[model samples]
Target: MCGIAAVLNLSLAPVPHLRPALGAMNRLLQHRGPDGEGTWVHPRGVAGFAHRRLSIIDLATGQQPMTDGRGNWITYNGEIYNYVELRAELGAQEFVTTSDTEVILRAYARWGADCLTHLRGMFAFALWDEDRQTLFCARDRFGIKPLYYTVVDRMLYVASEVKALLPFVPEVETDLEGFKDYLTFQFCLSGKTLFRGVGELPPGHVLLARNGGVETRRYWEVYYHPDFDHTAKYFEERIRALIQESVAVHQRSDVPVGAYVSGGLDSSIVAGLAAERQGPGFKGFTGKFSLDPAYDESAYARDLARSRGFELHEVDITADDFVGSIEKVIYHLDYPVAGPGSFPQFMVSQLASRHRKVLLGGQGGDEVFGGYARYLIAYFEQCIKAAIDGTMHSGNFIVTYESIIPNLGSLREYKPLLQEFWREGLFEDLDQRYFRLINRAGVLREEIKWEALGPYSPYATFQ
Candidate 1:
């Protein structure tokens, strides 16, 4: 991914200092794109856009903050994986560059904000519509890339990371409500961030700033419309086809691509499919801890690499390495995330960066497939409750007690979580029960200032 930053004078007048401040913001994200850097201040000095470019698709000319001769300019991060098809559909002869960035700009020029519907990729971008004098900004549908913005003195500062907005903000202060949300749910709900006054542009949403006013509206949403009519075999075939097609499209790149093979089902499947398309020279990276055999999974990665005829690189993570890099890692992450997984993931990413500019992994598999231990724990309690209440045949039940009996053994290892979740929410509604299952705030209640956090229920927000 590249990095993008913008400064918009909501007053609709000149802000001389903003042009230099935009350059400084892009410098903070230099690590994201060391290949190139560019900045542009609107002729009227009302806005400025900057880009840190990591050339991926078109290594020769994929520079940014690029513009169309008609006065539209864009500073974009992430790729449009289906750009080739989109370019063909948009009439390839009209474009000057092979870069996906141009495709996005032209798409917007033709379709306006409706252009978001035609794009199929991860992106967070800000485009200046010179004619309308509007700054149109959007984050991708899944939030794979980040876009943060905060309004200061009616001047809006937007960047790929919060650190870029530091110099301009009044002071670095904690957002108490966001902190409380993080304490309760390990993530902030809505567009909240730990930094006071800064808000993330939620995925599938667009932001338009003009004439001293900012407006945001959702452009897309993921609705669960279950297909009850389809047979199991039909779904299986569709899923397989979708996965193959997804991997094929993701493999589009001008540079060699690699995989992060974790020796697990999801990553293994991704690696296998990528290897099939990548052929003999594919590279795979894995990280394992040498402290215990149970902590290591590199052997499985080796086995897959051997069978798939791909080169495998391994890193043995140690306590010393963690100690050395923990501070840097936390600094880069801005705030703490879920767990210790980020540490190893960082190590493996460092290993991969040595050989490849792009690497694929199976990150969202667990969330999509309900593979997390908490899901099983919560569902196990549901099964027990259903059996006791004689709701085995309830129309709302997705899995009956009998169907889940064989998997009950998995709960044995999650006894602590089961205890915490069931202690208060037994026989409660699903939303309340699931809320209890994920809540991590009880242990820190004494340390929090309730008044500062305000009257908010994370559970209510979650629902």
Candidate 2:
């Protein structure tokens, strides 16, 4: 939602050139924060922090490079959904601004490093502690916002985007390991990027820079332990309640917000619920393809929009548009982290931006629910292997196999799956074989063979 950048090195005062480079880096992220820009350089010339604001909550008062008034300063990106309550809990100290940014600074004053626990939201922030002469940075629990950094000669350069950090670096070169991961998994799995010497501040982590040294440690982890004790009906009611509560809170914006409905079950549910809160002035956005019926879900979206009384906006994207703007979209992405659909999402974002500054959509439903077809294939293979091993009956295997084989026929359309799974490791143990086959970005493509790639490939040594 915003862009934040910082330059830190306590070992030496920041030279005159450092400020220009920091400004350049911050300027590169203007699109992320078209509302306004703020820059704060430590008078001692040791550090500089910059922010690009989108003007979400407190349009007038919520400006970044906000200070705690004791020389400690913060430049942040994100919304603390619980900031209202957090401000109340922090004990009234005659609040100055209504922005969440102030809440974070004050919360840090009270809780120190433990402040991370009291906060709940997506954020990547850098706070300068003038008293301790240390710089503290943190990323949200999930990777909703991005923070990338690299240290060169004790000077730490951090930014919301990897491309923003490029301005401060001497030269840029491909990170081969990141490329190999992309070739295998269609994404970079490691915190490392496609650029050498650049590293990501992993989610749910905090960074402390002081005395010419920086230390980063995890602050939170989302562990999964199924609640088997709870009744199914209880969980169903709880889920419905949570969804309504979350939608209610998110609708608390001062600006008009829109919905992006994909017509999928997940997005429809969100749009439907949000429509309950939003009025007739609410608008919905959807992407359509006139050339492909299979990819066109705009009709279903139209139904939802009509039923929900939403003024719908639909954009029909073509292959030519894909070819033209893909390079631009990937430029904004900083790397090819997403598939071809990213360009459509880019168009969708652009459309949503024209109507409303903020739009809520069911983006991570598949990841959260394991709704990906790959999960189905992986589970099916496990069952078939269990049947062959006599761990499960052959009758169960037949039913599962028959039900799934029809879908597997389309596997030929995907070269990675066929090339990786076809007789590649069939003789190996079931899990082992499937492991080699499953992530098919199952990420197990045979082209990822690193034996002869020598010891230079980071992924090779890593695997």
Candidate 3:
């Protein structure tokens, strides 16, 4: 949605490089926001903030380091979908711009950090309070967008992506433990990254930095506490309501919006709901690998588009595409953490950007609905481990997993995965076993011999 950078130093006078460093960080994030760029330095020359915007909402008047005409200033990314409602709740202020960034500033003034409780959309933002002389920063509930920061030489530097921090702290070197985690888990397992000094702002949390010290606190958190009292019919109605409501609100944009349809159940449902609300002539995009039937789903996408009466666009990617863009992809990603899926996804994103500025996808449906094939494999291995160790009767597993919930046709293609999971007595601990399941990549398994990985294992949680 946007890029944000800030430098705060309260305990010492500002250095000459601090303001220029903010500009360099903003340049590194040009991809995140190409619509506009702005930077502001505090009057005392001790603190500065910068913004790069994609111009999704209030395109004309929404620019940052937006100020309240008072001293408070903010540079924010991602949308606050409920701003229209929030604006009403705040009653009449001067109302200079129709931007949600203003809604955030007023809300903070009225409620302080309590404003986070009223927000509903994905976001990562920094707000500067001149009156209190404090710097406040936060990431959204799910960390959909990212916020990275580090403290060096008593000045705090924060940015939307990790690469931006490198300019200021170029002397910082590799993090061996983080590198080990990336090899085993395919991504940094904790806030610590491959770089030694930088760390991420954990999701649903806030940091307040002042006087050369910073304090971080959790503004929200995620927990699973299942309730069984509700009837099946009640849940069905709720799900239906949520689907319609979410699709309608997420389509809130001054610019054109499009959906990424893969023809899978999740993408199909998302596209179908959007088509119903958006009417005919809506646009959709999909990607396919012409080399293999296993990877090609654009045909199904065509069928859905015809049924929904929306315009359909498709892109075909070849091995050459992978070879050419792999370097750039890894550069933008900062780490090759994900699977080959990122390649095709990038092509599809490029295709969609030509038609619409805003694109939505069913990105997390697999994790949310237990749709990943790996989940079935993981559960089956757990059952086998339980049977051998006499924990089969421990009453720890649900009865539905006993028969492989949705029968997977042929596990022949999945054997390499199973071998990787079961080898090295990996199923011994539930946490370690679960880690293997998430990090399961047959390609990675085949490339890196298990013997070399003997000394390396994943930590259950970030220490």
Please give the CA lDDT of all the candidate structures: 0.89, 0.80, 0.82
Q: List the candidate 2 regions with Cα displacement exceeding 4 Å.
A: 385-422, 425-453, 456-463
Q: Could you tell me which 10 consecutive residues in candidate 1 have the lowest summed lDDT?
A: 394-403
As a whole number from 0 to 100, the lDDT of residue 297 in candidate 2 is 92
Q: Estimate the TM-score of every prediction.
A: 0.97, 0.89, 0.89
Model 2: clashing residue pairs? 14-45, 438-442, 439-442, 439-443
Tens digits of per-residue lDDT for model 1 on 1-463?
7889999889988875976798799889998898999999888898999999888988887889999889999999999988999899889999989999999998998899999999999999999999999999999999999999999998999999998988899999988878889999898889999999999899999999987799888999988866778787999999999999999999999999899999998998899899989898899999999799988989999999998989999999999999999998998888879888999999999999999999989999999989888888777778888778877776655666666778878777878877777676577888888888888886676687777778877777799
Q: In what order do the candidates fall by lDDT, top score first? A: 1, 3, 2
TM-score of 3: 0.89
Backbone steric clashes in candidate 3, count: 0
lDDT tens readout by residue for model 2, 1-463: 9999998875857645777877898789998999999899888788898889998888888988898788999999988888889989886565799888999999999889999998887899999988888899999998788999998777899999998888667789877777666655566655778888888888898989888788888999978756657776998999899888887777667688888888898888888888878777888899999798988999999999888888889889988988888888978988776556788888888888888988788878888766665655565666667658777653423235556667666555555554656546554555555456534244445755656433554334335
79, model 2: CA deviation in Å? 1.3
The per-residue C-alpha lDDT of model 1 at residue 416 equals: 80
Question: Whole-model lDDT for model 1 versus the true structure?
Answer: 0.89
Q: Which candidate is the best by lDDT?
A: 1
TM-score-sorted candidate list, best first? 1, 3, 2
Off by over 4 Å in 3: 10-12, 92-94, 381-412, 424-429, 439-457, 460-463
Per-residue lDDT of 153-187 in model 3, one digit per residue for the tens?
78888899888888778586877667667775677
Steric clashes per prediction? 0, 4, 0
